[model samples]
Target: MATRARGRGSGRHDGQPGHGRHTTATARPARTRNPLVTAPGTLATPADRALRGKAARTRVPRSAHASWLPSVDRPDPVAVLERQGRDRLPELLPIRYGRMAASPFAFLRGAAAVMAADLAAAPHTGLTVQLCGDAHLLNFGLYASPERALLFDLNDFDETYPGPFEWDVKRLAVSVAVAARENGHPEAKAGRAAQEAVTAYRTAIRRLARLGELDVWYTRIDAEQLLPLARSTRHRRRAESSLGRARRRTSLQAYGKLTEVVDGRRRIIEDPPLIEPAGTSDMAFLRKIFSDYRSTLSEERRLLLDRYRFVDAARKVVGVGSVGLRCFIVLLAGRDADDPLFLQIKEARQSVLEEHLPSGPYVHHGHRVVAGQRLLQAASDIFLGWMTGPQGRAFYWRQLRDMKGSADVAGMSPADLVSYARLCGTALARAHARSGDRIAIAGYLGNADTFDRAVTAFALSYADQTVTDHATLGAAVAAGLISAAPGV
Candidate 1:
């Protein structure tokens, strides 16, 4: 096995390749930067390292890569969509077509992990940390509680792992700035916003160092605290209101939209392709497996679920970035068709974390994702769990979007945008502190200014490449090398 190739269950095994955490923190100097970030991240195993050859050439600084990203005229946007869709097939039902037709930028937002692997592997001066691999402008957001309290946090952790801290921080700064530029903010203004994100990250890292290790581990950002930190009375009042609105965002709420009551039977509404059931064979198999799945759950959970009877299910497509991948939403009905419960079981592929770190003792990749996500996120879906089926494929289950919300990247003014950037910056560092040493990280960062400069340098440069990649896909589409049904 070459150094770059992480194999099945390779994530839990420490024997093979790069640095990574398995289930907990490691005892090591946090200040050490991986030479691989600048060097070739060649795995000890040649076979794995061979995969790194896809785009090994050196190019201009990442800051420069952004200039050409917006030139959609140079690339065929439709072809890019087709390439993205190609990976998402056999599982995509038709209802998600409207979502796929959402802007190219929206698609880019969902696929940031795909971008991170290409960018991080390009240069390997191995600055490693517990990275939020899918960091981007809109991924940061607020969630509320039953009592109507709002808390800010990093909402996505599907791609979090030990990797270059630069990758996480750079992705955020560039995303916010790039997103701002797309919204027509001035260049200098956009640059400053990016800088503020770096500042917040630097500031947060130091604060994390001050907390007791266990205290830091126990901390969570509460939604109700927004009342005291409110920038204005109006802001406070609005937060209080949004909190109330959040309570209604439940599985019950979602069930009403996705299913219906037809003569007292709770069934999913099928309008052509939008939301439909799986084929008869798949459904028949699932019916039996769901009974088996119930036995696998804890007695308490099993009893809780016994209240709801499993109904028919379908492979449902969801989210812009995940439009082309395998995803399904299973429906359950209790007592009456009106009392519905929805469970989202998304396919868990190997994480980008696996590529950077060697696998440990884990036998399943889904276990790795579930374990890593539980460790990293301050708030997680209550139903989070992992399972396997059909060729031993892995999947993690959760409530799809229970009270889930995102930042208003398009709506925020420059000032509010900077404020939001700072929020993400702090959250990213906090997540890193969970498995990586914050103090050693702070020492390496050493007063923040220099680290901030390096981050800004990399962020600006990589943003430029995303634009280039976008254009390359565009050209492929125009040349008829790929099939495209744009604005789907």
Candidate 2:
């Protein structure tokens, strides 16, 4: 266990101070509901107002963040990777390391736990929020809301939980910095991108704090709305191109590419390692899981789901960090062959942040993920729910691919990259404000670029660390110390 120097409390609710030390991972008493989200004008309190003054007066200045990174006895980054692989699929663990070895940015995405360890050692304001524990640049994307409208938000929640809001922002800042480097952008450009993300987060949270609570909760950035934020014609053009492609990426579109007629019926296409049909034992086990999942859904949703009958399922490998985790795609059909539904059943484990933050209130990690998603997202999947499997594994289920899309940062020019960075920052702030005390957080930030610059410096320094860590992983793969199946 590690401990960070507590700068000054935000005068808000008490977050786990000195989180680096060992904490209990067992469940605690359940909370009926989140108290941060309140009716208009009720989100803040008299204490919050006084705390704002206290924070602005005596809290550690943001500039002090420049020296937050501890230079002593840091844990071995390679050892951390090996530790995380312990419970993952042995055959697929190599692919996880291989993808991480692809580039520094890829490594950043796959190494959330590594950064979480570092962040636990850094100085932080004691402001806890339901954090997107792995809030890297790529994780923020466009997805279909319940209304069927495309909206921009944090799309990954595998590690979402209660932790310092700064952790999420720091991860995002480093990701932008690393992405810029991966694209061969100048160091100055990379620094500027990281700074812009911090600035956007600061500005957005301040604005949201001033608004009525409901108004802030209701706010969401739609795909079309983001175009106006682009700073240049090039930025706008690239965003439009990305948005156009996203609009066509519906469940129907995925059905065409991911399925085919097998004799007289349709089934998921097999692409060994990446996508393969389930075995008899797995299929039987999944049937029971599906029944438990249906019980978790609301009556209306269950009725809607009942209209479809289970057809088939397959093991599907997804994402860099989640590569070795157990994930499956289940197919269902309605009255006709054209009527289809795809549900993604992903295994849920304790959040990486749990080791450094407060333990979750939910007994099941699947419930923790679902509850956190609902708390952070402006709107979530109608099918989102969770269930425990016979083997005691927890899982969350959601629509497989309904108009989901992420930006191709590699293709973006430096200018466009900066613009995208700001968008991600804005999304991160919005997500935090939904489940955190916006007024308290805004007060801690003040109206200065002090924190912004400090975080940018941290991001760049951490980006360098990431490069070194990534090289270590690559070396391990080459040395035959670890198996690595490339070209997945």
Best by lDDT: 2
lDDT of each prediction vs. the true structure? 0.59, 0.82
Backbone steric clashes in candidate 2, count:
1
Q: Please, what are the lDDT tens digits per residue for candidate 1 over residues 1-488?
A: 00111112212112322222322223221334432233477422322222222111111222221221222233244443454455456344232333433443554565554554444333332335666677887777675433444556776666666665656777788787677666777766777778789888878877887787788886667766645645788767866776666666777778867777678766777753435577887677566556645654568777877898878677775655665555667888788776777887776665655544544335665565666666777756555667776767766676665776665578767777777787788888888778665654564555626556545554555455556555665565567665445544
Model 1: C-alpha RMSD to truth? Answer: 10.2
Model 1: weakest 10-residue lDDT segment is 1-10
- Runs of candidate 1 with Cα error greater than 4 angstroms are 1-87, 90-104, 122-128, 144-150, 227-241, 271-274, 288-299, 335-338
Whole-model lDDT, model 2 = 0.82
Every model's Cα RMSD, please? 10.2, 5.0
Measured by TM-score, the strongest candidate is 2
Q: What is the lDDT of residue 450 in candidate 2?
A: 75
All candidates: TM-score: 0.76, 0.91
Kindly report which residue stretches of model 2 are placed more than 4 angstroms away from their true locations once superposed.
Answer: 1-18, 22-47, 50-60, 68-71, 230-237
